[model samples]
Target chain A: MSQPASNAKPIILTGDRPTGPLHLGHFVGSLRNRVSYQDDYNQFIMLADSQALTDNMDDTNKVHRNVVEVALDYMACGIDPAKSTILIQSQIPELAELTFYYLNLVTVARLERNPTVKQEIVLRGFERDIPAGFLTYPASQAADISAFKASIVPVGEDQIPMIEQTNEIVRKFNRLVGKEILVECKAVVPEVGRLPGIDGKAKMSKSLGNVINLGASADEIKAAVKMVYTDPLHLKVSDPGHLEGNVAFIYLDAFDTDKAGVQEMKDHYTRGGLGDSVVKKRLEAVLQDMLAPIRARREELAQDKGYIMQVLKEGTMRAREVAARTTDEVKAALGLSYF
Target chain B: MSQPASNAKPIILTGDRPTGPLHLGHFVGSLRNRVSYQDDYNQFIMLADSQALTDNMDDTNKVHRNVVEVALDYMACGIDPAKSTILIQSQIPELAELTFYYLNLVTVARLERNPTVKQEIVLRGFERDIPAGFLTYPASQAADISAFKASIVPVGEDQIPMIEQTNEIVRKFNRLVGKEILVECKAVVPEVGRLPGIDGKAKMSKSLGNVINLGASADEIKAAVKMVYTDPLHLKVSDPGHLEGNVAFIYLDAFDTDKAGVQEMKDHYTRGGLGDSVVKKRLEAVLQDMLAPIRARREELAQDKGYIMQVLKEGTMRAREVAARTTDEVKAALGLSYF
Candidate 1:
């Protein structure tokens, strides 16, 4: 049953908000790591639709439609439903309850001072109109992490403080209850994180219109490669190119399996005589080769939306059991366990 | 069946934070009204343990123990379980989910600006250490109200802002989803809302040692009556007594049903012929009469804790069904209706 029980391995929790379809930036930063993590760790990949709603409450249709698109992307990129549990956040309901309890442990001023939330508020230009849920999202995230007792969370360096906050709640809950009912999690910061956009922005955001969707067609990939940000100072084939901030080079660095070949091309381009077209062709070819199988698989999965939903339903069912056990324990700790 | 099913009447939502045994201040201000309201309204009385955790997170046992005590207070005061549903808020997990959703409709600044929340913050001396749950309790209250589609919320005047916040969430949720999914609730502000403390303070509070519990013994009632505040200038029976700010006179006005006798006593006291001891003795007798039956019922119910728990469990089961239906509708409206 259940492939000889994968619970022997340590648990890792990771996923993206289902506000939009994922992109190459997501793949290079987190999804690729998660696909590998499923083998070594008991992985739970969440489709954070509720967290998506904290910001996209006005356009719920966008969040609803993207759940399937994001699921397709996950399956296409080889996130095996048999090995990894892929669940929707809203479906559990226990997470919300856990979040409610955790909110009591965190001070409002401390939440406002969370660097990630503070930066996001400014980035979204929320000013004084910050939705109460958006401000309390870190508490919600703490629930997501501790509900599974996940020991490992794969996130970027910018999200280290979230792990700290989760542990703070974990410690506070246990100390207040005089029992260790919840576990603290550690952030696993990847060395190769964050792929720049085709426009060379620090973040590949959908609103910026610079991101290439993971399910992008071959033509779309080719077009994006053609417009990839290259060194403007390198006007002629004889001129030496600067590799820093070059989107094509960055994508090649992230996708190319032949490290020696990429290093040779970089040297040739830096020393002059490597035409931009040649590098663009190589980058386009590499991207097409990497994404062709994923694109075809995504197309095939898209045809059977019912199967994807079934997988999520089963996964959410499994996830709910785990979260419910934790919630019961939390309630018991809080002395709220009524028969 | 079940007394012709009280679900036919308009629903009323009301409750107390079960942080302590309910007291005389609770009875005169709201419990008496609720006992009468149960026949005319499909009442849902919530034991707000979760809300109690907002400020009393460090002492959750207080919330837990008081749930049964408070339930005893209600049952003793003739809140028929067959007419009014008695539920523990934490038992209905859907309320937490609904609260998470409703929080998105309110802004951090908007919740911070609520006059009731603002005043309470200062009174509690929370300053910069307000718990996130405390800051967002209005959203939780909105969930408690709208989950039952409650149109009437019996509350004091100070709590009107909470009802306003609830309606704002209901309107915003319906307008956002383009459907009338949740009903707006109205605050039924009681004219005789507050009962002064034994020390003649504006409010009776347990911490101030000025409240008489609904389950107080006859001797306890007499002792509390003996300490009731009176006019300091009335040194002798010949000295004129001021009835204003005199807690015993106020309590007589609140509990003594014989209005003509109370009026006669007031006139005699104003005419400088009645002694303070006479009023205190009269208050003691009135309190003993009012509390005797209730105290007996509370004592009998306390002997059978399991039965009280079973009642709450059954009521919570019924409450869960009502809340679940509304949660589904809310999810459907938000386009989060994933199977």
Candidate 2:
């Protein structure tokens, strides 16, 4: 996160949780948007390993190792570290301190009312035993957004509630301080957000294990395409297939550039002659073509983890300074600066 | 917050919320014990301004100014800054980071079930609108205790649950790490752990405004003694008085050095030959004698606020080093260290 030195670009804050390696779903949903925003906006891409530990506390070593994996995936997916600051959340202690103060501005009931947090708790099956971190992550998210004074956050439809919660905290903080020191961020919902998983889950989350990683090998990609959810009624080559809810067609729609060819296949499949294996072959070919270079780049970047860490170190050092300034302003507003 | 040398002194973690000046109740409850322990125990006395803002978010400036007032009270009451590390909570960012990780180990249901927090929510009339910080403060307190690896925590009967919560978090972290990196602390409940307010409200607290501050002027102490809750049935000079729950008698019992003389006065009051005015005169005298030197010392210290801040700065700088080491260990335990 750089200073706003006469640059009119609004800061964009977005990142992955680093629970695992990046996936096709991540590519279409956020990584691609991050790449697009890197040049036009002052981008701060975060590897949110600490936030990932809220539910993954059982496997912290995994979180530790995935920082590099996510960083590698970001680089492989065209997120230029020079243009977008790629920071590790755990390295920036100011965010935690910022969250400590922001926590007082929001009520426990408000956090419970956050639709995104509620959905997350339910998804994690933490019903009555929700970790305090999970419930208060929205405040932490708000701290991340306000620490950089980010005015734009790229998120999917399900995460719109998170943006609302961040703005609420911003408004409450400003109202308490009697000044607008924190900027409210708006969600940049991409047109191709929320890519369904290969197994047809609503979202491709790590916990569900239904995802195909961006670094998936050709064999793994082939297996995933064969297992892609499609119409069960059309078992024979002569039987007509329904296009609705077909994961293969959805993948083609999202990734394939040959629109007319895909349309021809959809028509043939809808009529009564296209075999399921034929459609699977086309989907697998498209996915292989898309992920082969990314896989190669990821392997190449993975060779030297030291360079990945150095990039994170430099980014975090710069981000630490920006976040420290924001925290100082917040403390001054609260009259908490003792010295 | 000093390093544990070959001296082999068990560490004590204790502190006060810098909401206001220390009162007579504070002197009797914990401040006296803190002074006594400074010689033999490795003590870290914290001014918990961050925790104070949990419910007092609107009056942050009060919490800020009172950090010095509390430090003054600490010094005035014989807590030597040379022996005790008197640090400010907000100055140690490591504690906040430690608390961020500790929050993942505690559950929302567990925090909700804390008896002290429940009582505080009811006392503050924050039934449904409890601040998230207020609810999560036990986690923060655990952070404070574990950050020092403190084995002794000076608390009252009301705070036994807090000690229990701290130990629970410690055990959870140890269990997750498969080793006991965090030591559980035992609560040292002083003999005079709690003192009744002047209004006989069972407890003297800043929010209740029923306290006679240690820095109270002679006239203020006298007025407070005059308003002290006494036996209402013994209004006449010839009526017998009940000493139980009588705050005037309680103060005399706690502060008066001449035990035989106090017993003589109690006998006369029980035998229907003493007036409330007469007993109040003696209680006022006892309070005045006890508070005179403390008030003078507090006044002397108040003249140089810079010295008080300097004490905090030096103490906090030392404390920051200790806590940073602890946080580094915790992060290492969680395998979150990147560089």
Q: Model 2 off-target regions past 4 Å? A: A1-6, A231-240, B1-6, B236-238
DockQ: which candidate is best? 1
Candidate 1: misplaced stretches above 4 Å? A1-7, B1-7
Q: What local lDDT does model 2 show for residue B289?
A: 88
Provide the lowest-lDDT 10-residue window in model 2 chain A.
A1-10
Pairs that collide in candidate 2 are: none
Clashes of each: 0, 0
Docking class for candidate 2: medium
Please report, as a residue range, the 10-residue window in candidate 1 chain B with the lowest summed lDDT.
B1-10
For residues A1-339, could you state the per-residue lDDT of candidate 1 as single tens digits? 212245578889998898888899889888888888888888999999999999999899999999889999999999999999999999999999999989999999999989999888999999999999999999999999999989899998889988899999999998899888888888999879888878889878788889888899989998888889999999999999999999889988999999999999999999999988999999999999999999999999999988999999999999889999999989988888889
* Candidate 2 lDDT tens digits, A42-110: 899888988999988999988998888889999999988899999989999999999999889899999
User: How much TM-score does chain B earn in each model?
Assistant: 0.97, 0.96
Query: Candidate 2 chain B: minimum summed lDDT over ten consecutive residues — where?
Result: B1-10
List TM-scores for all candidates, in order: 0.97, 0.95
